[model samples]
Target: MVTGKMFDMTTPAALLADDTAYAEAVETAVKAAAAYYATGESALDDEAYDRLARAITAYEAEHPERVLPGSPSGKVAGGAAQGDVPHTVAMLSLDNVFSPEEFTTWAASVERRIGRPVAGWSVEPKLDGLAVAARYVDGRLARLITRGDGRAGEDVSHAIGTIVGLPEKLGEPATLEVRGEVLMTTDQFERANTVRTAHGGAPFVNPRNGAAGSLRAKDRPYTVEMTFFCYGALPLPDTAAELADALGESTHSEVLDRVAGLGVHTAADTAVPPRTASGAAEVLERVAEIAGLRAELPFGIDGVVIKADSAADQRDAGSGTRAPRWAIAFKLPAVEKVTTLVSVEWNVGRTGIIAPRAVLEPVRIDGSTVTYATLHNPADITGRDLRIGDHVMVYKAGDVIPRVEAPVAHLRTGAEQPIVFPEVCPQCGSEIDTSEQRWRCVRGRDCRVVASISYAVGRDQLDIEGLGTTRVVQLVDAGLAGDVADLFTLTREQLLSLDRMGETSTDNLLAAIDAAKRQPLARVLAALGVRGTGRSMSRRIARHFATMDRLRAADAAAIEQVEGIGTGKAPVIVEELAELAPLIDKLTVAGVNMTEPGATPPPAEGEEPAPSDAGGPLAGQTVVVTGAMTGSLEKLSRNQVNELVERAGGKSSSSVSKRTALVVAGEKAGSKRAKAEELGIPLMTPAEFAALVADFLDEE
Candidate 1:
């Protein structure tokens, strides 16, 4: 077990004075580093480890004559890892600065050491993964070596064929060593875990751990893919003298470009590529820019690296025993934290999917106190080897929900208990369907009547003002309602008999329920909570068929003609609507509206077809709206804008794809807007979209 007492004892004099405490602190740090470097699993998170190491460094600086041999100060991998294979050039670590003030101080020091202003700065994301040296001989990938220590590394050539971006052959015939990081992208990590578990292996806790373990493994039944991104390149001792001279003379930016040209991946291939910053200010700006885009990046980054771009400047600044004097890492806040798994909760969703949720020990991560995280499914819990009372890594990025990455098995004390999954539905005590990865109640939405009914009364659905989840549960428990259709049959006397139901509240609720009968067929379909349809999809379906009777008559083939409804989903929708026939009949008898306004119904058999509105600007177009609207659209909600699109004879979509006809990009448009541009889809500003849809705006 690793102790974090040193994190609290930050004072150098206080730690140096206590001999026993100081020694314990050193031992704790050494063990943490060893675990982190060897398997990418540590008892402490990155921020905690950094703080403890900084304290040790401060104490050592004051008592240089009494420094311990196991001290982590001025050491690569904290002097905990070593190997026999010597690196062509020392794979030195970068000294870190946590803030802009510290970065500015480091930059000033580098300028003073060089005796002149630096030529330029190269700023790039500091990838969070295992550092390695990839050697090439005669343009062929020859070996892969991990950065065991600064001077030497362990050979991991077994991973050569499995790594993407690091090609088997270079674009040109050359003998050199390229230094880069080997990591699993977000998508790769999930796939690796799935493949690993299928092969009867324990799932890796995180991407970094997966990469480290996969890189060194041999003779495994499964191969997990990883990605490589070169940050620097150097000439080997056997390299041509002319090439060595050119490599030594080239600037960092130029060398990276050449690396990318040689079929080796670099930061140049990413969205936030290395930029040449004129000074410290620009470098800091680049750092912030990269940090802002961290959540959106495919791979993980712990910090941003800033280095002197000019080779001459790097030579003048010189190197330290563990790091370079000319480069510094601007560290970002840690997005992952190690916390205890207190317990697991099984929740029945509206559709009866029994999801497992991890209850954590309230650890602070990425500026929030995360007490709960998503566990995905029961299979995930088993594959990850997670247990109650075990230490687990909790990861949160930007607006995404927190998730339990994996259990830190090394930190288990044997007291941890296995997480038990339910054989029956947790909410209704019914048999669960476990054929799929996600367990579900055999009764589907009926198993959770309260939640399903509450959704039906939501603002965008039936618009019943007084009915919420609590009221729905009360009504269900009192036997006054069993489903959305039963809600319309609730009588005044039955509602008045409830404990909290006053005369005023009951009358208001009754009026709301009566008003709901006139809602459009689209809203009524949305209230049904079909498995494969949502609000927008319901609008598309209702508009296509025009009436409930026609919609009930549609087969999978007819449903497939609706916008965004594919072959697979069309069948599912048709099946669900068929099962909901009894509920639809009840609602129809209760006088709920079954027709959509402004929708053109399909022609009857042997009937003449209506003329097409070919002159309409968006007659055959599929349009998507993204980001915050402005101008005339400022007062309109997203659903209202979608309504306007349909009124103008366009099919509105929530995602951008190759089939997308146009995109209305508003202010602060993010990935969807970017995807539209990438696909070469037509784009319009919000003002331009507003002008085009002016004739249909009032139709809402």
Candidate 2:
């Protein structure tokens, strides 16, 4: 058994100044780490071990010649196994960026090293799972190795059959090595815990811990479902872009596609192509999008990986002693915290769905003071055995809403009371419908009209500038509005009667309400708050039908024809539409547009349009706009550039691929400009783009 202090408490700077002290610290950290991984126990927590490792790394950096031979700085952390299998290539750890500024700084450093701006980048979700390297010989599974210590790892070939998304053989015969993450999904983690509990075993903490335990377990019933998502490969290509090209693929995005085709699972809709000359801004946006989607994903993601998309650029940037210089992990802020569960509150939504919320002692998480967290539903409460007065683990779902993950059962002193679901509506004291796990109020619109109206004016929907929750409540309480459509009917006198309303406020609110009528049909659909439809689904529906009249006339079968709308949702859509007909008619009578804006109509018969430049000024042609712009376009955002391209009847592309027809080079344009010149694609200045747009608008 390991005993005494696991790590030496030495400051990184101080340790770096002394070679002998740093070497001893590294030795202690490595031995302790190995013992912990091999025995499933540790004297030092992850943070302590990480600090020691970091010190070693800092010391090695300052005195590269004096670096110890068997230094832990050169090895993967927590990679200690009973037996070793040599890795074909070292499994390196990534350098991390916790904020947008850091990520931007890292990108700037890369550009400085490459002596040119990066044209494109690949952004992918960073999976919080165990790392594994799978080797295939003659297209058959030859070996599976853990990321034990960079050079060597534990052989887990015996557990290959039990792993999901990892095929024993490829479709074609080829010698390849695939490196990826092994993890258990949230569902699988829960199921495993359930089985373990039934057999009188303690539950696993989280999916990451559960995956590690299941993979290392050498026993019968090796059927604990695990999943693999491939991120890298060997023969060790300089970059993902190089790997793609070597495999006859066009871009890094195509590399992931090919990996998926080879029977490995990769996160869907998570790969974002780089836009803009610097690539930093586009990557940061992608990171934000991924963070927003974290809670909704089946598996867990702690951050996003951003990499330079050009093979030559990556080669020029090269690698550090451990991490690649071309790539960085942009991590989301920590969302988990232990907080006291003061009580449970049942909150009512616009749809009359009554959900349980945990009223907590105020705790700060991810820079926000979270006092209440979502309990999901009554079933979730019971399944997790959450109770009042219990110490609970609170985490932000998708880095957005705070949610109760689980209770710290060991902290319970038998004084905790089981949280009971409300039998009556909190708003109206009406009988609650508990037929499903999610309790709802039978009162429906009568009790939820305020919420419905508030949602209608929300930013994602109508975006009424002056219509806020307070005004919405006042309108509802005064009986001036009963539903969302009733807001349009509200008179100036009624608005003036509200506590805070004046002539200016009343006129602004009315004008905002009037402007909402001209919003796209998709926005109108989203404002209606259909049971299963969101902004994206509503957009799909609007694009499909083109007009509100067509959407209203669409039956269940017709609605189901749209992608993402399955058979189960189709009938619901039909039923909801029928129920909302009266409200739809009211909005139509209020002079709503009833049509999606910017939708392209079908071509006229006997008219053949020219092949290039099809849509607007840039129509039928793929155009790439890069760098900062001058003149009127100077102040426009990067997104505005793409918008201008699309508005000019041209397709806006992020990368200058072979498919590109035109390159709009702005002020200080970089590698993309060079690439455009090399590829013989027509290059235009920002002034030219502005002139082209002006010409198109003039013609219109």
Which residue segments of model 2 deviate by more than 4 Å? 1-127, 132-139, 142-155, 164-167, 170-181, 184-205, 217-344, 358-374, 383-417, 458-466, 491-520, 546-550, 585-700
User: Candidate 1 has which clashing residue pairs, if any?
Assistant: none
Best by TM-score: 1
Maximum-lDDT candidate: 1
Each model's lDDT: 0.87, 0.72
Model 1: how far is 137 from its true place, Å? Answer: 2.1
For all predicted structures, in order, the TM-scores are 0.84, 0.59
TM-score of 2: 0.59
Error of 2 at 386 (Å): 4.5
Q: How many clashes (backbone N, Cα, C below 3 Å) per candidate? A: 0, 12
Q: Please provide, for model 1 over 500-607, each residue's C-alpha lDDT reduced to its tens digit, 9 standing for 90 to 100.
A: 999999999999999999999998999999878998999988988989999999899989989789998998888889889999999999999999887877677798
**Per-residue lDDT of model 2, residues 1-700, tens digit only:** 1111211112232354586788678777877676445432333433355566677877778788987777766445533443478776667678766556667788899999999988688888788787889887767887888887666888888778877878898776656788888888879988877775555454554666567777777873435788888876554333344443565433445556666677766664232222222466666655655654455567877677887877677678988666788888876655566678999988888878898888999986655689999888987777677889988767665345888766766557999987876768998999987887778788765678878888888877887888788888888778888888887888899899889899999999999989888887878998988877876677668756778888888888888877689998898788778878888999999787689766543233476733332356676788898878998777666644665565576666666766799999987675566556645799999888788888543322
